[model samples]
Target: MSDPLDKATSKAPATLGEGCLSRYDPDDLSSEDGTEFPGAAELWEQLQDTSDSPEEQASAAAQGRH
Candidate 1:
């Protein structure tokens, strides 16, 4: 893996008191404790995107999409 701290890396370290949404709960993305993001069904529904056709799914998978 590439070193994120290497000088070549363009990534900048977060300033003090920085809080990343993705790091709200590293162990559980759902944030079941409710301290961070609430476990909202609407969010999950939006992520599924059932409107996409089967061909689109195959194309996305072939392109290495999550």
Candidate 2:
């Protein structure tokens, strides 16, 4: 069997700023252009389903943060 450390080191390094391997600095999410990504509507729909009304859902979601 191969040594585990040797196996890990032998693999190719990931391409920078590519795919999920890209490192995210907090500043990268500050601008609309930098932070624009898919799934806002779908996430909102999920939150809506968890509460009886839009107002209730928003309140519950706010509470969930803390």
Candidate 3:
């Protein structure tokens, strides 16, 4: 290709639904697409243990402590 932009161009995987409900089609995704996150569950649990619930955060923010 003659244009440098051609090398930078990338396309998203196929999607499903429409509007706010739209999302990537899982069946079309692969590891090459960076879809794998092996530590996500562990990280989620760690975050859950360290962070307060939404209601608690809102209360802290309203009290000007957040």
Instruction: Give TM per candidate.
Output: 0.28, 0.27, 0.63
Compared with the true structure, all predictions reach lDDT values of 0.58, 0.61, 0.88
Q: What's the true lDDT of residue 41 in model 3?
A: 100
- Per-residue error (Å), model 2, residue 64: 29
Best by TM-score: 3
Model 3 TM-score, 2 decimals: 0.63
Show model 2 residue runs off by greater than 4 Å.
1-33, 53-66
Q: List ranges where model 1 is wrong by over 4 Å.
A: 1-48
Q: C-alpha displacement of 31 in model 1, angstroms?
A: 24
* Higher-ranked by lDDT: 2 or 3: 3
Candidate 2 residue pairs in clash (backbone atoms < 3 Å): none
Backbone N/Cα/C clashes per model: 0, 0, 0
lDDT of 2 by residue, 8-50 (tens): 6343333347678676555534544346657888988777576
Quote the lDDT for 50 in model 2. Answer: 66
lDDT of 1 by residue, 20-59 (tens): 6333333433334444645677788677767668998898
TM-score computed on alpha carbons, candidate 1 = 0.28
When summed lDDT is taken over every stretch of 10 residues in candidate 3, the lowest stretch is 1-10
